[model samples]
Target: MNHLRVSGLRKRYGEQEVVAGIDLELRPGECFGLLGPNGAGKTTTLRLCLGLIDPDGGEIEVLGLPVPARAREARRRTGVVPQADNLDPDFTVEENLLVYGRYFGLRQAEARARIPALLEFAGLSARAASRIQTLSGGMKRRLTLARALINDPDLIFLDEPTTGLDPQARHLIWERLRQLLNQGKTVFLTTHFMDEAERLAHRLAIMDRGRIIAHGAPRELIAKHIEPQVVEVYGDGAGRWAREFGQAHSERCEQTGETIFCYTHDADSLVHHLDQRSGLRYLHRPANLEDVFLKLTGRELRD
Candidate 1:
């Protein structure tokens, strides 16, 4: 059975619609990614799914329970890690887990008994006695993720879970999330990092203007929506290159500021042309998820 389902999901504020007619499904043990630029309504969609806010139109079912009506019950099977760290600075690492477990009706004794195992899983077993304020950013993030699992939820909602962290910290979280998937836990997450989505998500949806413009496995989306190869020509004489050789060799070309992107079935011709053009730095590579994203969303800044 699908772990989560949404059909024609929509929401609005005044005359402006933020989430419009979105349909999605997630299977067990998969990481599903929701991606969009700023103001594209990714967060609103998440809130609606969580039943924290009512949608103006459509249906949402999380864990086979209709949301809002059965939101409380569904939430018991769901874990949430917000964009910001909301850990209590006054509490110790172990104490924080114990306190959070109470919301799921876990007794103090039960919560305490789970603490050691949870700490070990998060690599915080040695720091269980440390105060929250003394922990590093990465440590705090791990604690937050650990706390979310206090109730042993089947599904987790991670909102920009690794934002602002160094590469090492981000990879650690990714590894742990992969471990969760191995154990058959479903993860639904939102992220601004295209690379992150590409690495972790088994499938993803791209939202724009409050609607899902595309959804599929990352590789599938790339193959369907973008060229197989790309030649990114930047620096001096880039615009001239686009005008002269772009249309002749490429299936599509897009110019954004100082860079000209040439999308083609093959990059041999473009690479040959670049070899002749001195001082023009160019990169020929297989089309990536970021290329597909920029193609669909435009290279212009959202904000």
Candidate 2:
């Protein structure tokens, strides 16, 4: 059975529609990702699913229960790690977990009994007595994740869970999330980091301007919308290269920043064409999620 279902979802702020219309489904044990630039309505969609705000139109079901009407019951089976770490500075590492568990109706004794295991799982067993303010950014993130799991939820929502962190810290969080998946927990996440979504999501939907532009497995989307290989030409005369190559292969060329990218399955033909031109140094590589994002959504800044 699908763990979550959303159909024709719509939300608006006054007369301005932020989420025009959207639909998605997530099966058990699947890691589904929502990718988009800022103001693309990713957060608004999450809020609608969580029943934090009522959607102007459409439906949302979590674990077979309709949201808001059954939000309380649905919440009991759900966990969330918001974009920001909202840990209480006054509480100790263990204290935070205990406090959050209370919201799920866990008794003090029951919450206490779960503390040691939860701390160990979050990698905070060694810092159980430390105040929240004393933890490092990575530690705080882990604690937030642990707090979400205190209720032993079946499904979890992670919103930009590792936005600002070192590579090591990010990898640690990824490993932990993978462990959760191994235990059959479903995860729904939103991220701007292409690598994060590429590495973790089983399938994803890319949103733009409050609508889904593309949806599928990362590899599938790349294959369907972009060439397997891309040749990136840089340095001086990049624009000339883009113009010349774009005219020769109008369907396969894109210019961004100081580079001209040529996307094609026949890399050798493009390479032969470039060899005749001077000041046209390039790199040939496989296309990734970023390439697909750029192809579907033009290189325009969105706030």
Top TM-score hit:
1
Report the C-alpha lDDT of model 1 over 189-250, residue by residue, as the tens digit. Answer: 99988999999999999998998999999999999999999988998689888998876899
lDDT minimum window of 10 residues, candidate 1: 291-300
Give the CA lDDT, 0 to 100, for residue 67 in model 1. 94
- Total backbone collisions, model 2: 0
- Tens-digit per-residue lDDT, 1-303, candidate 2: 788999999999988899998999999999999999988899999888888989889999999999868888999999999998999888899989999999999999999998898899889899999998889999999999999999988999999999998899999999999999999999999999999999999999999989999999999999999989888888888788677564476347877788888888878877777788877798888999999988787788886
lDDT of 2 at 289: 99
TM-score of each: 0.97, 0.95
lDDT for predicted candidate 2 compared with the true structure: 0.90
Off by over 4 Å in 1: none
Error of 2 at 203 (Å): 0.8
Query: What is every candidate's alpha-carbon RMSD to the true fold?
Result: 1.1, 1.6
